[model samples]
Target: MADDMTDNMLILSMISQVFALILRSSFLSGGLGDA
Candidate 1:
């Protein structure tokens, strides 16, 4: 049970990180385009 919980947390963390990276890159591109 504990292992399953840990796995889930890890998966969530990875997903969030990926989303953050995508958002950051998109924002940068948008800023450059605006300039």
Candidate 2:
């Protein structure tokens, strides 16, 4: 059970990192277009 929980945590962290990168990229593109 502990190992499963750690695996889930790792996946969640990696997903969050990817999500954040996507958001940052979108924001940058939008800003550049607007400017």
Residue 31 lDDT, candidate 2, scale 0-100: 53
RMSD of 2: 3.7
Candidate 2 lands at a TM-score of 0.83
Candidate 1 lDDT tens digits, 1-35: 99999999999999999989887887888854654
Regions of candidate 2 where Cα sits further than 4 Å from its true position: 31-35
lDDT of 2 by residue, 1-35 (tens): 99999999999999999989887887888854653
- Each candidate: what lDDT? 0.87, 0.88
Model 2 alpha-carbon miss at residue 17, Å = 0.2
Q: Estimate each model's TM-score.
A: 0.83, 0.83
